[model samples]
Target: MAEVEIVVAHRERATLRVGEVFLKVDADRARADAEVEAMALAPVPTPRVLWRAPPVLALAALPGTALDSTASPAAWAAAGAAARALHDAPPPPWPGPSPEEIAARLDRECAWFAADDVLPADLLTRNRRLADTALRPWTPVFTHGDLQASHVFADGDAITGVLDWSEAAPGDALSDLATLTLGREERLADVLAGYDADVDTGLIHAWWSLRCLLVVRWLVEHGFDPRPEIAVLEARR
Candidate 1:
């Protein structure tokens, strides 16, 4: 029998790896459903669903390492191209949040962080100011809303698969690009080369600040380290 390896575990969800399959347990079935639907709709490669039982979704393990380290520039570019392909695909009909909604979220998170004292006021203030540009109107795209480096898996210079679709939705295209290159600014050129489109790098930076600021509270409350996100926020200064 294969030893069960815990991929991630928290109150709301957990994932375990056993042999070649990964079992995801989500307290919220809607998120799981969304993930499945998004994967099915996505133009890029996604993990194969082996089976499903309410609250437990079994997926075949993808065969590549996370894109955080030892990934060639070609692989990084491939990931970007994959993102572009997904964006080009028809977006889900369901509406995503508007700029007003996003601004409200930023205000709420910023206020909470300010009062909590978990983050320095200056850091919050600066990033909050930087987040302004990202609030502008954007043509929605089918976005992997949480497209971080770790969520992308690459085999050499080719992208094998992208993991975690729970947050997929129609949103700002730059948000996806920003998330992919977050904390890895050095790789921006390669990714953009693959993206092959005119993008406002400033807006990408703004999203970087916005996302990090918004996610800090959730990460802290969930008992996960928020340092990486905070680092990104600080960089905005």
Candidate 2:
């Protein structure tokens, strides 16, 4: 079997090469495509959508690399600037699940865990606790929900494009900030310092903790072990 050359593999979506075009598919690719189209009107580097379906999108390919731990400070700065640009863009018509709605969804997922009796009891309780406490306050902005190093692409110091729009939504920018802040604290600090206004580190930390719990639940639901790093992060809360 010939495997598709995957440019990026996300939990919910994958970017695969089909000849010269790239296909993005998952449960939310259509919405993602629309969002990206809307974002393109602003001054940001998003992949150009060529076609769309509810859970699939076709985009033009761009050259770059994922901003992993080995990425340069310039890459982080580019990502930060891109994020700020997206946040500043006019709100799109595509509606995102509200925090309260997301909380409800989490509760439903927790129920699945309870019914299956697969997840530890403490895990469920902690997930709810963090969702309630940390994610409750904050204004929502257009956020790339999974803005980690892996979703960013760089050609030298410049960010060529941002990838994985599956989780793109109107949410607390802190959520995006937290994901970007992972691993490289000093670089994260520098990125924030370069932002237009002061960012609340406490809020970013809180969102990070909450997002960690959510990631754990997602892993458990999908039958993968939550790595020690994720486990430790969730426990620290």
Top of the candidates by lDDT: 1
Off by over 4 Å in 2: 1-3, 7-13, 18-20, 26-42, 50-56, 108-131, 183-186, 223-225, 232-237
Report model 2's TM-score to 2 decimal places: 0.76
Candidate 1, 120-186: lDDT as tens digits: 7877778888998789988889999999999899988999899999888889999999999999999
Question: How many backbone overlaps does candidate 2 show?
Answer: 0
How would you encode candidate 2's per-residue C-alpha lDDT over 111-165 as one tens digit per residue? 7657875446776576556556655756678877778777678888788987666
Model 2 alpha-carbon miss at residue 199, Å? 1.1
Q: What's the count of clashing pairs in each model shown?
A: 0, 0
Candidate 1: Cα lDDT at 59 = 96
The positional error of residue 90 in candidate 1, measured at the CA in angstroms, is 0.5
Q: State how far residue 28 of model 2 sits from its true place (Å).
A: 5.6
